[model samples]
Target chain A: MTDPDTDRHNAKMAKKKAARDKIMATKTDEKGLVIVHTGKGKGKSSSAFGMIFRCIAHDMPCAVVQFIKGGMGTGERDLIIKNFSDLCDFHTMGEGFTWETQDKSRDIEMAQAAWAKAKELIADPVNRMVLLDEINIAIRYDYVDVAEVVTFLRDHKPPMTHVVLTGRNAREELIELADLVTEMELVKHPFRSGVKAQAGVEF
Target chain B: MTDPDTDRHNAKMAKKKAARDKIMATKTDEKGLVIVHTGKGKGKSSSAFGMIFRCIAHDMPCAVVQFIKGGMGTGERDLIIKNFSDLCDFHTMGEGFTWETQDKSRDIEMAQAAWAKAKELIADPVNRMVLLDEINIAIRYDYVDVAEVVTFLRDHKPPMTHVVLTGRNAREELIELADLVTEMELVKHPFRSGVKAQAGVEF
Candidate 1:
């Protein structure tokens, strides 16, 4: 006993629902933006690694460009050198650490190479996530162009791709543009005790 | 200026130094092993990701097999989903954690598939590093064979390829043989305040 107008309206609603479902089915999302982990604290890169695990939980690919520490002697690095290449693209800068490298020019050169590789990843549409590990410290050291980095990320971000920047001394402009930013303050560290970093712990 | 016998001794010493230098130059150890990050702490895989950055500094490779988290709408996962298929080989158990999985049998099935991949890497002689990620927690859940894992690691560990296993409740036997062990105790957690995990911090 419904009126013709009511029946037609119900029919229109059904069509609209169908159209929404169709859009949902066919939609392809470009990835998200960037996450920056910084501050003079502990566990910045550690936080980024947690994201890697989360991404992998769903079988997403991830890439890492480590800028600060390039040592091959650490146990953790040893493990990655042996295994994660297949899971993710991993590139290390040549310098171990600024304090450890002892030569400032040498450290900057290594950082530049790492940045070159990292730049390629950030530009690629296929790379969903890129972690610029410890590049903040390099920026602080005047090793690379902070302005260039900020501009590149804003201009060249891929659809659906996300990047994470980690290190001490994240610049203010970079933090402002980041989708998320964290600062870790170190209350204590075993290093102050003159204890050498154990293989698996610090590295 | 020395006698003929003394000159010969000096020549031998110089030759020994040269040979040592040559060996160092020719060594294939540009990379090291991959870590299997596990544990119940707030940031086990986070630590691993930090190391991934370290590996990239050396232009090395790394693999991460994420277990016990997946199929949910997570900001981190969505951000990196684009990268999982190629540059990084990531497999999420899709079962979430033990409490969340609710079905014990399902967890075991998923964990077995994960271990299959881990076993392959563990047995491979050429993989620079292999990160099992959470096999230790799986073992605690009765998802994997502790004995089999121990045997495989002991007998099949490739020369120069190192493995890092992280997780809470790591069996004493596994600890005994580890070249390095780091115990991360939870001092405080957001969950205590009834805060759900943030996308970047806990993902």
Candidate 2:
């Protein structure tokens, strides 16, 4: 026989409980992550930023390492790191993106160190979200070893960590390992029509 | 007869001249301006992030205040803001998106304050970039005064400043004034297909 008081309590819990708690209780959190944002489109990094913004709002520990564009000349990194010093950890490999870098060896080295840093954070289940900006394109150029990256992510700690990889030209192997994957296929671009990259539009 | 050396120089200059440059050169610099992004597709904010990331690399001043998400807790803001603290500004409004806001008065109030902050920064030419993310949607809901925003932009300074607006439902006036505009129209979404919003893909 179903007790009336027990049924009433269950109803209350269903209506008032935190949605996150409900989700966490039902699904086993998968620590494994791989997000490949590829396309001839804009906003690949911005898509990753959306995740970063959301993750931090949730109180999840996170880190960001932009491979090709993490240099001293950028304004976004400066603006972000200065304001939220206590809650976030920001690191740039001090290397610009490949198209801007002429030396292939240096490019590869930057990508390698970036991968290592990402691996270090992933190992610490405390870092829940990791944004690897423009990584797939770097991998495509062999700027870093894709095999090593795949292996590291596959072995990442589960139930407490997540990783977000954003760039164009995502690999099939990486996509296969990703529990969640978003492919941003570009349909149009202003640069194609001869518009220069504005400071806030294309930076 | 014209000098051969002068003729050569004249030819070179003529070859490099652009049809629009003469007019553009005379226009005043855009000290700063706000960009609003909204749409059915993903990556509205990602585009803004690309600019932000690029700005951070350059050591330019920038501030990001994302509304429609907060208090859920995330580490994206926490981690990057740590190392690049001197360069960037990161603030999440923590009140999840407007669709979820359901409170019209609260939404309007949030829009007003956020717009106030963005306008303040944007008016400063030294700020470089001020992305008023999702401003289009806010305007659509009457959360902001669309006419007033257009008037401010119409009287903008150029070159020295730039405003990047990202979002769907860009009003007639906003698009007319935008030096650059991009629309991310949705073809498909994972959320509609029953896949939950992933940490990195859709935070």
The regions of model 2 sitting more than 4 angstroms off are A1-32, A46-61, A69-73, A76-117, A142-152, A155-159, A182-203, B1-38, B46-127, B142-151, B156-159, B166-176, B182-203
Which ten contiguous residues of candidate 1 chain B have the minimum total lDDT? B29-38
Give candidates' CA RMSD values in order: 14.7, 10.5
| TM-score against native, each model | 0.47, 0.59
**How high is the DockQ of candidate 1?**
0.07
Q: Write the per-residue lDDT of candidate 1 for residues B128-155, one digit (tens) a residue.
A: 4556666678787667888877787877
Taking the tens digit of each residue's C-alpha lDDT, what string does model 2 give over B27-86?
544334334444455677665666766666676776665544532224345544764556
CAPRI quality of model 2: incorrect
**lDDT per residue as tens, model 1, A76-187:** 3444446555556777776665555445556668888888898898787666678888888888877888998898889887856778888878888888777656555443
Task: Write down the worst ten-residue block by lDDT for model 2 chain A.
Answer: A70-79
Q: What TM-score would candidate 1 get against the native? A: 0.47
- Location of the lowest summed lDDT over 10 successive residues in candidate 2 chain B: B67-76
